[model samples]
Target chain A: MSADPQRGPLPAWSLPAGETDRIRIATQWPEEVTREWAWGGATGAGVRVCVLDSGVEADHPLVGGLAGAKVISLSPEGEVVVADDSEGDVVGHGTACAGIIRGLAPKVELWSVRVLGAGATGSGPVLMEGLRWAVDQGFDVVNMSLSTTKSQFAGVLHELADSAYFRRTLLVASAHNMPVESYPWRFSSVISVGSHEEEDPFTFYYNPEPPVEFFARGVNLDVAWRGGGRIRATGNSFATPHMAGICALVLSTHRELIPFQLKSVLYLTATNVGGDR
Target chain B: MSEPGRLQAAVAAGVVGSDEAYRALLQSIVEVARAIFGARASSIFLLDETTDELVFEAVAGEGADTLIGTRIPSSTGIAGWVLVTRQPLVLEDVTQDPRFARDVAERTGYVPQGLMSVPLLHEERALGVLNVLDRPQQARFTLEEMDLLGMFANQAAIALDLLQRARRARALVDHNASGDTAAVARLAETIETLEDERRAAGVRLVQALDDILRGA
Candidate 1:
């Protein structure tokens, strides 16, 4: 079970035993730029963002709206079934991601496209199919907070981004915060976002150059899970939405803007993270 | 010798007033048109605000005639329709469309089959029309083509507006002889903004346009 928010700042993810005293400073990323960078209602409300991860609970206050999710239920005779709302995040991890995206682009219509199973261990094909479907369905932005090792969908993803560019769409992927060799963050076609832990010691792990393009406040970040228990989250998964939100904001303001415009705006506005990479 | 954006800069810089500025501005426009489109014909028209008519102001085409004084009514022809609606007009068969007035055809003696006409609009106030005639018959105007014309037209409108303002300011500067301080200050402000925007956007435009050209 994750720590409760009522307990105030989970200790496990907190600075371990007073190591917070001499935490080395790095790039001067902004604090709470939801105002300066957001431009508020400039964009975000008009477009649809498909979050392909664990199923999101429809009833969650942060997770309101039908969003038209697809879920296949199975019968005893090895038959497929339909459970649209049931496809939502079964584990609390997916909920954490969904909330981050929701907080950022609140007005955006989100489709909780669930491709991962309970363990967050769905095969590569499942996620790729979701991405193709999202593009086909005319989503303006796609948020992928999941990744893999044996994924054959890398080339397909490049094609997907190019096609989205042709159709004027954006793909926002999380640069895995786990410090693992992963394809999700390393892909060039997608905007790779990493986490920057403000006042936390674990910040450097999130910095090195795998696919990290932009940085967002990520360490000990608060996210609500099932059963009213909340936990301070850690990982690049938590950071990706900030970049996605910024992209959605831009795409929304300048609808006629192509992908190049979208890319330029982000790079221009980004506060360069770390020093070396 | 000055390019379009740079000449606009010189005018803003007080090197010359509106008349000379517009004269050079229009020339550079047609020159760029000749360079990029490889078209033998190009022209610019100024809208008469009071009469709402298109009066041809400049021309650069093969055997391009002086329709300089001809005033085409806003409600009358193809170019007129383009000006009124602020929508681009393309004609693969010029004689086929009822909007094509045949006045330019009769005047220039060029029976052009393909034509592209873009509305010269400044903030929804249709200034006139920027037209290229005798375009190759097989050429179809794509969205990019339409937008490119619109972009060129946008720059032209800015230069033209500045040109007009500069001309009026020249008259004021001569007549008032430095007594009318307030109006002169406002004129200086407008000129500065235009020149500044052009100068700043020029640098960005070169980089971004190169990136776009290289297919990035």
Candidate 2:
């Protein structure tokens, strides 16, 4: 069916009814891979999740006690400086993401990699350094709620994303809220996410489109903010962490699942794909 | 004055032929944005790279009178965040958020309850920020609203870029001329009247000339 014209055309990375197709998976096992088998009852225990954004507030009630936190900054001499993050959540954006992940995967080890500074202002070099550090740490999942529009950093981001994928560190990145070109999220190696209006955190959809792989709840979320407060927020920024939390859940149960395998599990168990079954 | 010397004098003076048209364009953008979002106010802040500050360039509704030409550090508030991240942000309750930079808002004499800010970007470079503050309904900003705001910011960025280029061109022309800046004024007017594609091409040509003149 054609999309309703009144809705002002379908958004990018969304599939119309006519566009969605059913595909049969040829699995070695006779039983179909269901949501129950994938992540049900999985508390994301033993999974290491790195939130690569502004720092997270360790004391935020919704996001209790981070495993560790680090800040990426440039020294006066232009050298990359990685230091302990004593000051937390410069803009509350990272704390919001971390809180969502914590809510979904309570037992997961959450680490904060502060890339953005106060008021969420950050440079591309700091972001790249932060991502590189996260990749080196080999976190089970990395939630990147922010992206750099600078094309100059795309090459390095692409390499880092691929390295994460190969090393079994699933990178969950938020698609730009605007229809603009951005890095890492657009890379095939990452799980690119967009927003849906649904309130259920577990409800997610796998887009037939290539770039944006999934859609999750991101509208009007009451998320934890800095200073142990909560605020209403929206954007693809929040949706990405939901996917990361889910990834943590899957990895928690099936430690041997690689990045590509984890992605396949997500697609097969998406609300749209496996809910009815 | 010799040709080279005249050009040098104009460049040093930072002469921008009349800025009436530029101001009018930005004013129209903020007005339309304010109306579209049903917001209490809308404003545009252009980054002054030399001073590392954000200059209030246009406004509709609140702070339209005394806020224009006011400067704040480019890295101080939500506008700075948008500028650095080149991303759109929507905050529902600015009053409770520390990142709202209340001190800066207090200086402007209007602190919004909620705000949506987007980067005014020309290609990858962020030229400024477009902010829509405190819609009467206090409704949460939707993804669609953010997307529409981004489109508006793109248009604003192009106009701002052209205005900056016009200033440089006016400097070069005003310097060589013996107190007459009409040539550059006519060129700016002509460029503004061109079709979208041609206008962008024309702006590029002017920018190239400006770069070459500066290098000389």
| Per-model DockQ against the true two-chain complex | 0.00, 0.23
- Candidate 2 interface RMSD, angstroms, 1 decimal: 3.1
Model 1 local distance difference test score = 0.57
Alpha carbon lDDT of each predicted model: 0.57, 0.82
- Please, what are the lDDT tens digits per residue for candidate 1 over residues B57-88? 76777544655556655534446534532334
lDDT of 1 by residue, A75-106 (tens): 44634333466544544445555666677667
- Model 1 alpha-carbon miss at residue A95, Å: 2.2
Task: Give the winner by lDDT.
Answer: 2
Tell me the lDDT of model 2 at A120.
Answer: 24
Best by TM-score: 2
Q: For residue A149, give model 1's deviation from the true position in Å.
A: 1.0
- Tell me the spans in candidate 2 whose CA falls farther than 4 Å from its real position: A1-30, A118-122, B1-18, B98-101, B138-140, B170-216
Which residue runs of candidate 1 sit more than 4 Å off their true CA positions?
A1-43, A72-83, A118-122, A177-181, A199-210, A273-277, B1-216
Shares of reference contacts reproduced by the candidates, in order, are: 0.00, 0.30
